[model samples]
Target: MTAHYFIGIKVEKSIRTKLTEWQNVLAKSMNYKDWTSEEDFHITLKFLGGCSDKTIDVYKNKLMNEEWPGAFRIAIGPAGYFGNPKQPRVFYADAEKPKELEVIKLEVEKIGSELGFQTEGRTYRPHVTLAKKNAEGMSPLALESYDLLLDESYSMLIDHFSIFRIHPQQNPKYEAIAHISLNKEE
Candidate 1:
Protein backbone atom coordinates (compact mmCIF):
# COMPACT_ATOMS: atom_id res chain seq x y z
CA MET A 1 0.00 0.00 0.00
CA THR A 2 1.12 3.54 -0.67
CA ALA A 3 2.01 5.77 2.32
CA HIS A 4 2.21 9.49 2.86
CA TYR A 5 5.58 11.09 3.47
CA PHE A 6 7.32 14.46 3.85
CA ILE A 7 10.82 15.84 4.49
CA GLY A 8 11.48 18.25 7.36
CA ILE A 9 13.91 19.59 9.92
CA LYS A 10 13.06 18.50 13.44
CA VAL A 11 13.02 21.28 15.99
CA GLU A 12 15.27 20.84 19.02
CA LYS A 13 13.53 20.09 22.32
CA SER A 14 14.32 23.39 24.03
CA ILE A 15 13.00 25.24 21.01
CA ARG A 16 9.91 23.04 20.93
CA THR A 17 9.24 23.83 24.58
CA LYS A 18 9.39 27.55 23.91
CA LEU A 19 7.13 27.18 20.88
CA THR A 20 4.63 25.12 22.86
CA GLU A 21 4.43 27.86 25.46
CA TRP A 22 3.77 30.34 22.70
CA GLN A 23 1.07 28.03 21.30
CA ASN A 24 -0.66 27.85 24.69
CA VAL A 25 -0.91 31.61 24.85
CA LEU A 26 -2.22 31.85 21.32
CA ALA A 27 -4.74 29.06 21.92
CA LYS A 28 -6.57 31.36 24.30
CA SER A 29 -7.10 34.00 21.65
CA MET A 30 -7.16 32.13 18.36
CA ASN A 31 -10.00 29.99 17.05
CA TYR A 32 -7.92 27.15 15.74
CA LYS A 33 -8.98 23.50 15.92
CA ASP A 34 -5.73 21.76 15.24
CA TRP A 35 -2.69 22.62 17.33
CA THR A 36 0.49 20.88 16.21
CA SER A 37 1.96 18.73 18.98
CA GLU A 38 5.27 19.99 20.27
CA GLU A 39 6.91 16.70 19.33
CA ASP A 40 5.69 17.09 15.75
CA PHE A 41 7.02 20.61 15.24
CA HIS A 42 9.18 20.90 12.13
CA ILE A 43 9.97 23.01 9.06
CA THR A 44 8.78 21.15 6.00
CA LEU A 45 11.03 20.87 2.95
CA LYS A 46 8.66 18.82 0.82
CA PHE A 47 5.33 17.09 1.18
CA LEU A 48 5.39 13.83 -0.81
CA GLY A 49 1.86 12.61 -0.21
CA GLY A 50 1.32 8.85 -0.87
CA CYS A 51 3.77 6.67 -2.74
CA SER A 52 4.94 3.07 -3.07
CA ASP A 53 7.52 1.46 -0.78
CA LYS A 54 9.83 0.98 -3.75
CA THR A 55 9.66 4.70 -4.46
CA ILE A 56 10.34 5.58 -0.82
CA ASP A 57 13.32 3.23 -0.72
CA VAL A 58 14.77 4.78 -3.87
CA TYR A 59 14.47 8.28 -2.39
CA LYS A 60 15.96 7.09 0.89
CA ASN A 61 19.01 5.62 -0.85
CA LYS A 62 19.52 8.79 -2.88
CA LEU A 63 19.32 10.92 0.25
CA MET A 64 21.82 8.71 2.06
CA ASN A 65 24.32 8.90 -0.77
CA GLU A 66 24.08 12.64 -1.31
CA GLU A 67 26.68 14.96 0.22
CA TRP A 68 25.19 16.43 3.34
CA PRO A 69 25.20 20.14 3.84
CA GLY A 70 26.88 20.63 7.24
CA ALA A 71 24.98 21.85 10.24
CA PHE A 72 23.51 25.36 10.26
CA ARG A 73 21.83 27.47 12.91
CA ILE A 74 18.40 29.08 12.66
CA ALA A 75 16.64 31.55 14.93
CA ILE A 76 12.90 31.53 15.56
CA GLY A 77 11.37 34.84 14.67
CA PRO A 78 7.95 36.53 15.09
CA ALA A 79 4.50 35.01 14.75
CA GLY A 80 2.84 35.19 11.37
CA TYR A 81 -0.08 33.90 9.32
CA PHE A 82 -0.37 32.41 5.84
CA GLY A 83 -3.04 33.33 3.28
CA ASN A 84 -4.98 36.53 3.72
CA PRO A 85 -3.85 38.43 6.80
CA LYS A 86 -7.52 39.34 7.25
CA GLN A 87 -8.61 35.65 7.20
CA PRO A 88 -5.44 33.65 7.63
CA ARG A 89 -5.50 29.87 7.44
CA VAL A 90 -2.31 28.85 9.21
CA PHE A 91 -0.61 30.33 12.25
CA TYR A 92 3.11 29.81 12.60
CA ALA A 93 6.39 31.00 14.08
CA ASP A 94 8.74 32.18 11.35
CA ALA A 95 12.37 31.11 10.90
CA GLU A 96 15.23 33.23 9.62
CA LYS A 97 16.13 31.25 6.49
CA PRO A 98 19.83 31.41 5.91
CA LYS A 99 21.47 30.34 2.65
CA GLU A 100 22.24 26.87 4.01
CA LEU A 101 18.57 26.14 4.62
CA GLU A 102 17.53 27.27 1.16
CA VAL A 103 20.22 25.18 -0.48
CA ILE A 104 19.07 22.09 1.37
CA LYS A 105 15.46 22.67 0.38
CA LEU A 106 16.45 23.08 -3.23
CA GLU A 107 18.37 19.80 -3.13
CA VAL A 108 15.41 17.97 -1.64
CA GLU A 109 13.11 19.32 -4.30
CA LYS A 110 15.49 18.28 -7.03
CA ILE A 111 15.81 14.74 -5.65
CA GLY A 112 12.08 14.41 -5.17
CA SER A 113 11.41 15.53 -8.72
CA GLU A 114 13.87 12.97 -10.05
CA LEU A 115 11.92 10.29 -8.18
CA GLY A 116 8.74 11.28 -10.07
CA PHE A 117 7.18 13.35 -7.31
CA GLN A 118 5.41 16.41 -8.63
CA THR A 119 7.23 19.69 -8.19
CA GLU A 120 5.86 22.08 -5.62
CA GLY A 121 4.23 25.04 -7.35
CA ARG A 122 4.46 27.44 -4.43
CA THR A 123 7.62 29.09 -3.17
CA TYR A 124 8.93 27.60 0.07
CA ARG A 125 8.24 29.66 3.16
CA PRO A 126 9.79 27.87 6.11
CA HIS A 127 7.82 28.11 9.33
CA VAL A 128 6.85 25.95 12.26
CA THR A 129 3.10 25.54 12.09
CA LEU A 130 1.47 26.24 15.43
CA ALA A 131 -2.25 25.98 14.66
CA LYS A 132 -4.80 25.90 11.82
CA LYS A 133 -7.89 28.01 11.56
CA ASN A 134 -11.06 26.28 12.76
CA ALA A 135 -13.78 28.79 13.24
CA GLU A 136 -15.34 30.07 10.06
CA GLY A 137 -16.24 33.59 11.05
CA MET A 138 -13.25 34.58 13.17
CA SER A 139 -11.35 37.47 11.66
CA PRO A 140 -7.60 37.19 11.14
CA LEU A 141 -7.32 40.69 12.60
CA ALA A 142 -7.82 39.04 16.00
CA LEU A 143 -4.63 37.04 15.52
CA GLU A 144 -2.37 39.49 13.65
CA SER A 145 -2.10 41.97 16.50
CA TYR A 146 -0.83 39.68 19.25
CA ASP A 147 2.90 39.91 20.05
CA LEU A 148 4.29 36.44 20.80
CA LEU A 149 7.49 37.20 22.63
CA LEU A 150 9.61 34.51 24.24
CA ASP A 151 12.05 35.36 27.02
CA GLU A 152 14.83 34.82 24.50
CA SER A 153 15.06 33.95 20.83
CA TYR A 154 14.95 30.19 20.31
CA SER A 155 17.72 28.91 18.10
CA MET A 156 18.80 25.40 17.01
CA LEU A 157 21.65 23.74 15.19
CA ILE A 158 20.05 21.79 12.36
CA ASP A 159 22.17 18.70 11.85
CA HIS A 160 19.67 16.38 10.24
CA PHE A 161 16.46 16.14 8.24
CA SER A 162 14.01 13.24 8.09
CA ILE A 163 11.40 11.51 5.98
CA PHE A 164 8.21 11.20 8.00
CA ARG A 165 5.13 9.09 7.40
CA ILE A 166 2.03 11.09 8.19
CA HIS A 167 -0.65 9.50 10.37
CA PRO A 168 -3.43 11.89 9.57
CA GLN A 169 -5.85 10.83 12.32
CA GLN A 170 -3.43 9.72 14.99
CA ASN A 171 -1.78 11.49 17.92
CA PRO A 172 1.96 12.13 17.61
CA LYS A 173 1.01 12.09 13.97
CA TYR A 174 4.39 12.24 12.25
CA GLU A 175 6.48 9.09 12.39
CA ALA A 176 10.10 9.39 11.31
CA ILE A 177 10.71 6.85 8.56
CA ALA A 178 14.28 7.83 7.84
CA HIS A 179 16.80 10.30 9.23
CA ILE A 180 19.68 11.55 7.04
CA SER A 181 22.53 13.09 9.02
CA LEU A 182 24.30 16.22 7.81
CA ASN A 183 27.80 15.34 9.04
CA LYS A 184 29.83 15.82 5.87
CA GLU A 185 33.33 16.98 6.77
CA GLU A 186 33.92 20.45 5.40
Candidate 2:
Protein backbone atom coordinates (compact mmCIF):
# COMPACT_ATOMS: atom_id res chain seq x y z
CA MET A 1 0.00 0.00 0.00
CA THR A 2 1.06 3.61 -0.69
CA ALA A 3 0.68 6.70 1.45
CA HIS A 4 0.68 9.33 -1.32
CA TYR A 5 -2.59 11.25 -1.44
CA PHE A 6 -4.46 14.40 -2.44
CA ILE A 7 -7.83 16.06 -1.92
CA GLY A 8 -9.78 16.85 -5.14
CA ILE A 9 -13.08 16.98 -6.89
CA LYS A 10 -13.49 14.12 -9.35
CA VAL A 11 -14.34 15.10 -12.90
CA GLU A 12 -17.75 14.01 -14.09
CA LYS A 13 -17.97 11.20 -16.67
CA SER A 14 -19.13 13.33 -19.56
CA ILE A 15 -16.24 15.69 -19.03
CA ARG A 16 -13.85 12.79 -18.70
CA THR A 17 -14.99 11.38 -22.02
CA LYS A 18 -14.49 14.74 -23.71
CA LEU A 19 -11.03 15.08 -22.20
CA THR A 20 -10.12 11.59 -23.32
CA GLU A 21 -11.05 12.51 -26.86
CA TRP A 22 -8.90 15.61 -26.61
CA GLN A 23 -6.05 13.51 -25.30
CA ASN A 24 -6.26 11.30 -28.36
CA VAL A 25 -6.01 14.32 -30.62
CA LEU A 26 -3.25 15.95 -28.55
CA ALA A 27 -1.12 12.80 -28.48
CA LYS A 28 -0.43 13.31 -32.18
CA SER A 29 1.05 16.77 -31.59
CA MET A 30 2.53 16.45 -28.11
CA ASN A 31 4.74 13.98 -26.32
CA TYR A 32 4.21 13.55 -22.62
CA LYS A 33 5.69 10.98 -20.27
CA ASP A 34 2.34 10.46 -18.64
CA TRP A 35 -1.05 11.39 -20.01
CA THR A 36 -3.46 11.50 -17.09
CA SER A 37 -5.73 8.49 -17.13
CA GLU A 38 -9.36 9.40 -17.82
CA GLU A 39 -10.47 7.77 -14.61
CA ASP A 40 -7.92 9.82 -12.67
CA PHE A 41 -9.09 13.25 -13.84
CA HIS A 42 -9.78 15.65 -10.96
CA ILE A 43 -9.60 19.26 -9.83
CA THR A 44 -6.95 19.05 -7.12
CA LEU A 45 -7.41 21.24 -4.05
CA LYS A 46 -4.50 20.05 -1.95
CA PHE A 47 -1.66 17.62 -2.33
CA LEU A 48 -0.86 16.21 1.13
CA GLY A 49 2.09 14.18 -0.21
CA GLY A 50 2.99 11.10 1.86
CA CYS A 51 1.11 10.59 5.10
CA SER A 52 0.62 7.77 7.57
CA ASP A 53 -2.67 5.88 7.69
CA LYS A 54 -3.34 7.41 11.09
CA THR A 55 -2.91 10.88 9.65
CA ILE A 56 -5.17 10.02 6.75
CA ASP A 57 -7.86 8.84 9.11
CA VAL A 58 -7.56 11.99 11.17
CA TYR A 59 -7.65 14.10 8.02
CA LYS A 60 -10.62 12.17 6.69
CA ASN A 61 -12.57 12.63 9.89
CA LYS A 62 -11.94 16.36 9.90
CA LEU A 63 -13.00 16.71 6.26
CA MET A 64 -16.16 14.66 6.63
CA ASN A 65 -17.17 16.68 9.65
CA GLU A 66 -16.54 20.10 8.13
CA GLU A 67 -19.30 22.03 6.43
CA TRP A 68 -18.99 22.82 2.68
CA PRO A 69 -21.01 25.03 0.39
CA GLY A 70 -23.77 23.21 -1.46
CA ALA A 71 -23.37 22.25 -5.09
CA PHE A 72 -22.30 25.05 -7.45
CA ARG A 73 -21.47 25.41 -11.12
CA ILE A 74 -18.06 26.28 -12.49
CA ALA A 75 -16.90 26.87 -16.07
CA ILE A 76 -14.09 24.65 -17.35
CA GLY A 77 -12.37 24.87 -20.66
CA PRO A 78 -9.92 26.47 -23.11
CA ALA A 79 -7.08 23.96 -23.09
CA GLY A 80 -3.98 25.53 -21.62
CA TYR A 81 -0.60 24.68 -20.13
CA PHE A 82 1.59 25.59 -17.20
CA GLY A 83 5.10 26.73 -17.96
CA ASN A 84 6.03 27.51 -21.59
CA PRO A 85 3.53 26.25 -24.13
CA LYS A 86 6.06 24.55 -26.44
CA GLN A 87 7.85 22.92 -23.53
CA PRO A 88 4.89 22.75 -21.18
CA ARG A 89 5.29 20.86 -17.93
CA VAL A 90 1.55 20.47 -17.46
CA PHE A 91 -1.29 20.48 -19.97
CA TYR A 92 -4.69 21.18 -18.41
CA ALA A 93 -8.31 22.24 -18.65
CA ASP A 94 -8.73 25.26 -16.41
CA ALA A 95 -11.69 26.42 -14.37
CA GLU A 96 -12.53 30.09 -14.01
CA LYS A 97 -11.73 31.15 -10.44
CA PRO A 98 -15.23 31.52 -9.17
CA LYS A 99 -15.71 32.39 -5.49
CA GLU A 100 -17.51 29.15 -4.68
CA LEU A 101 -14.50 27.05 -5.65
CA GLU A 102 -12.07 29.35 -3.91
CA VAL A 103 -13.96 29.05 -0.61
CA ILE A 104 -13.69 25.27 -0.63
CA LYS A 105 -9.99 25.42 -1.40
CA LEU A 106 -9.43 27.75 1.56
CA GLU A 107 -11.38 25.43 3.84
CA VAL A 108 -9.36 22.42 2.66
CA GLU A 109 -6.16 24.38 3.15
CA LYS A 110 -7.12 25.17 6.74
CA ILE A 111 -7.92 21.51 7.40
CA GLY A 112 -4.56 20.46 6.00
CA SER A 113 -2.68 23.03 8.09
CA GLU A 114 -4.46 21.93 11.29
CA LEU A 115 -3.12 18.42 10.64
CA GLY A 116 0.43 19.85 10.48
CA PHE A 117 0.79 19.82 6.71
CA GLN A 118 2.64 22.83 5.31
CA THR A 119 0.43 25.37 3.60
CA GLU A 120 0.56 25.63 -0.20
CA GLY A 121 2.17 28.94 -1.12
CA ARG A 122 0.96 29.31 -4.70
CA THR A 123 -2.15 31.12 -5.82
CA TYR A 124 -5.08 28.76 -6.28
CA ARG A 125 -5.54 28.25 -10.03
CA PRO A 126 -8.16 25.57 -10.47
CA HIS A 127 -7.36 23.11 -13.23
CA VAL A 128 -7.60 19.44 -14.11
CA THR A 129 -4.24 18.20 -15.34
CA LEU A 130 -4.31 16.46 -18.70
CA ALA A 131 -0.68 15.45 -18.90
CA LYS A 132 2.69 15.97 -17.23
CA LYS A 133 6.41 15.77 -18.12
CA ASN A 134 6.81 16.87 -21.71
CA ALA A 135 8.79 14.41 -23.79
CA GLU A 136 11.29 15.60 -26.36
CA GLY A 137 10.61 16.44 -30.02
CA MET A 138 7.02 17.45 -30.50
CA SER A 139 5.66 20.20 -32.72
CA PRO A 140 4.57 23.31 -30.88
CA LEU A 141 0.83 23.57 -30.41
CA ALA A 142 -0.50 26.09 -32.96
CA LEU A 143 -3.42 28.10 -31.62
CA GLU A 144 -5.26 28.70 -34.90
CA SER A 145 -5.33 25.06 -35.99
CA TYR A 146 -7.12 23.90 -32.87
CA ASP A 147 -9.78 26.60 -32.70
CA LEU A 148 -12.50 24.00 -32.13
CA LEU A 149 -10.51 22.58 -29.27
CA LEU A 150 -9.77 25.89 -27.55
CA ASP A 151 -12.85 27.96 -28.28
CA GLU A 152 -15.30 25.89 -26.25
CA SER A 153 -16.11 25.79 -22.55
CA TYR A 154 -17.95 23.31 -20.36
CA SER A 155 -19.90 23.79 -17.17
CA MET A 156 -19.17 21.38 -14.35
CA LEU A 157 -21.24 20.94 -11.22
CA ILE A 158 -19.47 20.55 -7.90
CA ASP A 159 -21.42 18.62 -5.34
CA HIS A 160 -18.70 16.66 -3.55
CA PHE A 161 -15.01 16.20 -3.00
CA SER A 162 -12.86 13.19 -2.16
CA ILE A 163 -9.58 12.11 -0.67
CA PHE A 164 -7.72 9.88 -3.12
CA ARG A 165 -4.91 7.41 -2.62
CA ILE A 166 -2.29 7.42 -5.34
CA HIS A 167 -1.28 4.08 -6.85
CA PRO A 168 1.35 4.82 -9.43
CA GLN A 169 1.53 1.27 -10.75
CA GLN A 170 -2.19 0.98 -11.31
CA ASN A 171 -3.83 1.80 -14.67
CA PRO A 172 -6.36 4.16 -13.10
CA LYS A 173 -4.00 5.32 -10.38
CA TYR A 174 -6.32 7.21 -8.05
CA GLU A 175 -8.54 5.45 -5.55
CA ALA A 176 -11.02 7.23 -3.32
CA ILE A 177 -10.31 7.00 0.39
CA ALA A 178 -13.38 8.97 1.35
CA HIS A 179 -16.09 11.09 -0.27
CA ILE A 180 -17.91 14.02 1.33
CA SER A 181 -20.80 15.70 -0.45
CA LEU A 182 -21.47 19.33 0.31
CA ASN A 183 -25.22 18.97 0.06
CA LYS A 184 -25.71 16.07 2.42
CA GLU A 185 -24.57 14.84 5.83
CA GLU A 186 -21.74 12.39 5.68
Candidate 3:
Protein backbone atom coordinates (compact mmCIF):
# COMPACT_ATOMS: atom_id res chain seq x y z
CA MET A 1 0.00 0.00 0.00
CA THR A 2 1.14 3.50 -0.85
CA ALA A 3 0.62 6.40 1.56
CA HIS A 4 1.79 10.01 1.22
CA TYR A 5 3.03 11.25 4.59
CA PHE A 6 4.29 14.64 5.74
CA ILE A 7 5.59 16.20 8.95
CA GLY A 8 3.99 19.62 9.20
CA ILE A 9 3.58 22.45 11.69
CA LYS A 10 -0.18 22.88 11.62
CA VAL A 11 -1.60 26.37 11.35
CA GLU A 12 -4.03 26.99 14.19
CA LYS A 13 -7.67 26.64 13.20
CA SER A 14 -8.47 30.08 14.64
CA ILE A 15 -6.32 31.77 11.99
CA ARG A 16 -7.51 29.65 9.09
CA THR A 17 -10.02 32.27 8.00
CA LYS A 18 -7.41 35.04 8.03
CA LEU A 19 -5.11 32.85 5.93
CA THR A 20 -7.96 32.10 3.52
CA GLU A 21 -8.68 35.80 3.14
CA TRP A 22 -5.05 36.44 2.16
CA GLN A 23 -5.38 33.73 -0.49
CA ASN A 24 -8.59 35.19 -1.80
CA VAL A 25 -7.00 38.61 -2.16
CA LEU A 26 -4.05 37.14 -4.05
CA ALA A 27 -6.44 35.27 -6.31
CA LYS A 28 -8.19 38.49 -7.19
CA SER A 29 -4.96 40.52 -7.62
CA MET A 30 -3.25 37.90 -9.78
CA ASN A 31 -6.54 37.23 -11.55
CA TYR A 32 -6.02 33.53 -10.90
CA LYS A 33 -8.46 31.62 -13.10
CA ASP A 34 -8.03 28.42 -11.17
CA TRP A 35 -9.29 28.04 -7.62
CA THR A 36 -7.45 26.49 -4.66
CA SER A 37 -9.72 25.35 -1.86
CA GLU A 38 -8.86 26.19 1.78
CA GLU A 39 -8.37 22.57 2.84
CA ASP A 40 -5.17 22.28 0.80
CA PHE A 41 -3.39 25.03 2.71
CA HIS A 42 -0.55 24.10 5.10
CA ILE A 43 3.18 24.71 5.63
CA THR A 44 4.99 21.46 4.93
CA LEU A 45 8.04 20.62 7.11
CA LYS A 46 8.92 17.38 5.37
CA PHE A 47 7.25 15.31 2.69
CA LEU A 48 7.65 11.56 3.19
CA GLY A 49 5.53 10.51 0.27
CA GLY A 50 4.19 6.98 -0.25
CA CYS A 51 5.27 4.50 2.39
CA SER A 52 4.09 1.25 3.92
CA ASP A 53 1.95 1.16 7.08
CA LYS A 54 4.86 -0.35 8.99
CA THR A 55 7.07 2.61 8.12
CA ILE A 56 4.34 5.00 9.17
CA ASP A 57 4.02 3.35 12.59
CA VAL A 58 7.78 3.38 13.14
CA TYR A 59 7.93 7.10 12.46
CA LYS A 60 4.96 7.79 14.70
CA ASN A 61 6.51 5.94 17.60
CA LYS A 62 9.77 7.78 17.13
CA LEU A 63 7.97 11.14 17.23
CA MET A 64 6.03 10.20 20.34
CA ASN A 65 9.27 9.61 22.19
CA GLU A 66 11.11 12.79 21.21
CA GLU A 67 10.73 16.21 22.80
CA TRP A 68 10.25 19.23 20.58
CA PRO A 69 12.19 22.49 21.14
CA GLY A 70 9.12 24.33 22.49
CA ALA A 71 5.98 26.13 21.48
CA PHE A 72 7.20 27.60 18.19
CA ARG A 73 5.55 30.68 16.78
CA ILE A 74 5.47 31.64 13.10
CA ALA A 75 4.14 34.71 11.38
CA ILE A 76 2.93 33.98 7.88
CA GLY A 77 3.28 36.27 4.94
CA PRO A 78 3.71 39.51 3.20
CA ALA A 79 3.36 37.38 0.03
CA GLY A 80 5.77 35.60 -2.33
CA TYR A 81 6.09 33.34 -5.39
CA PHE A 82 8.17 30.41 -6.49
CA GLY A 83 9.91 30.31 -9.90
CA ASN A 84 10.17 33.29 -12.20
CA PRO A 85 7.69 36.16 -11.83
CA LYS A 86 7.10 36.20 -15.58
CA GLN A 87 6.49 32.44 -15.46
CA PRO A 88 5.24 31.98 -11.93
CA ARG A 89 4.34 28.44 -10.85
CA VAL A 90 3.26 28.96 -7.23
CA PHE A 91 1.97 31.72 -4.98
CA TYR A 92 2.29 31.35 -1.20
CA ALA A 93 2.27 32.88 2.29
CA ASP A 94 5.87 33.84 2.98
CA ALA A 95 7.40 33.39 6.43
CA GLU A 96 9.15 36.41 7.90
CA LYS A 97 12.76 35.35 8.63
CA PRO A 98 11.75 31.79 9.48
CA LYS A 99 14.99 30.51 11.06
CA GLU A 100 13.10 28.60 13.77
CA LEU A 101 11.09 26.92 11.06
CA GLU A 102 14.28 25.95 9.26
CA VAL A 103 15.62 24.40 12.44
CA ILE A 104 12.43 22.38 12.89
CA LYS A 105 12.67 21.16 9.28
CA LEU A 106 16.31 20.13 9.64
CA GLU A 107 15.53 18.18 12.81
CA VAL A 108 12.62 16.32 11.18
CA GLU A 109 14.68 15.58 8.08
CA LYS A 110 17.52 14.19 10.15
CA ILE A 111 15.25 12.01 12.28
CA GLY A 112 13.19 10.81 9.28
CA SER A 113 16.30 9.99 7.24
CA GLU A 114 17.79 8.08 10.14
CA LEU A 115 14.58 6.04 10.18
CA GLY A 116 15.10 5.08 6.48
CA PHE A 117 12.95 7.67 4.81
CA GLN A 118 14.74 9.34 1.90
CA THR A 119 14.44 13.09 2.42
CA GLU A 120 13.60 15.69 -0.22
CA GLY A 121 16.59 17.28 -1.95
CA ARG A 122 15.11 20.78 -2.11
CA THR A 123 15.95 23.47 0.42
CA TYR A 124 13.10 24.33 2.79
CA ARG A 125 11.44 27.75 2.71
CA PRO A 126 8.40 27.66 4.97
CA HIS A 127 5.23 28.81 3.24
CA VAL A 128 1.51 28.19 2.98
CA THR A 129 0.92 27.60 -0.74
CA LEU A 130 -1.85 29.72 -2.24
CA ALA A 131 -2.20 28.53 -5.83
CA LYS A 132 -0.59 26.44 -8.54
CA LYS A 133 -0.34 26.99 -12.29
CA ASN A 134 0.05 24.13 -14.74
CA ALA A 135 2.87 23.40 -17.24
CA GLU A 136 0.76 25.02 -19.95
CA GLY A 137 1.46 28.30 -18.10
CA MET A 138 -0.50 31.26 -16.85
CA SER A 139 -1.59 34.25 -18.91
CA PRO A 140 0.83 37.19 -19.20
CA LEU A 141 -1.84 39.45 -17.75
CA ALA A 142 -2.21 37.19 -14.74
CA LEU A 143 1.55 36.86 -14.25
CA GLU A 144 2.32 40.58 -14.45
CA SER A 145 -0.67 41.68 -12.38
CA TYR A 146 0.04 39.16 -9.62
CA ASP A 147 0.33 41.37 -6.55
CA LEU A 148 0.12 39.19 -3.43
CA LEU A 149 -2.21 40.73 -0.89
CA LEU A 150 -1.26 39.67 2.60
CA ASP A 151 -3.38 42.00 4.68
CA GLU A 152 -4.61 39.03 6.64
CA SER A 153 -1.14 38.13 7.89
CA TYR A 154 -0.90 36.79 11.46
CA SER A 155 1.19 34.62 13.73
CA MET A 156 0.30 31.57 15.84
CA LEU A 157 1.99 29.39 18.41
CA ILE A 158 2.56 25.92 17.03
CA ASP A 159 2.18 23.76 20.13
CA HIS A 160 2.35 20.50 18.22
CA PHE A 161 3.22 18.77 14.97
CA SER A 162 1.20 16.28 12.96
CA ILE A 163 1.67 13.54 10.39
CA PHE A 164 -1.08 13.28 7.82
CA ARG A 165 -1.98 10.66 5.22
CA ILE A 166 -2.82 12.20 1.89
CA HIS A 167 -5.14 10.20 -0.34
CA PRO A 168 -6.51 11.00 -3.75
CA GLN A 169 -10.22 11.21 -4.63
CA GLN A 170 -11.94 11.03 -1.24
CA ASN A 171 -13.87 13.26 1.15
CA PRO A 172 -12.76 13.41 4.82
CA LYS A 173 -9.67 12.75 2.78
CA TYR A 174 -6.48 13.58 4.66
CA GLU A 175 -6.38 11.90 8.04
CA ALA A 176 -4.04 12.88 10.85
CA ILE A 177 -2.50 9.55 11.66
CA ALA A 178 -0.30 10.94 14.41
CA HIS A 179 0.56 14.02 16.46
CA ILE A 180 3.45 15.02 18.74
CA SER A 181 3.15 17.71 21.36
CA LEU A 182 5.74 20.49 21.30
CA ASN A 183 5.62 20.93 25.03
CA LYS A 184 6.67 17.99 27.21
CA GLU A 185 5.79 19.30 30.69
CA GLU A 186 2.27 20.27 29.69
Tell me the number of clashing residue pairs for each predicted model.
0, 0, 0
- Compared with the true structure, what per-residue lDDT tens digits does model 2 show for residues 1-186? 557999999999998988887787678778899899999999999999998999999999998888788888887786888887676888888877788789889999998999999999998889889988988544236544663765457899888999999988898999998998886533
- Screening candidate 3 with a backbone cut-off below 3 angstroms (N, C-alpha, C), the clashing residue pairs are none
C-alpha TM-score for every candidate: 0.90, 0.92, 0.81
Candidate numbers, best TM-score first, in rank order: 2, 1, 3
lDDT of 1: 0.82
Residue 35 lDDT in candidate 1: 86
List of clashing residue pairs for candidate 1: none
Off by over 4 Å in 3: 29-35, 97-99, 134-148, 171-173, 184-186
lDDT of 3: 0.69
RMSD of each: 2.4, 2.2, 3.3
Q: In candidate 1, where is summed lDDT lowest over 10 consecutive residues?
A: 135-144
- For candidate 3, give the lDDT of residue 96: 53
By TM-score, the better pick of 1 and 2 is: 2
Better of 1 and 3 by TM-score: 1
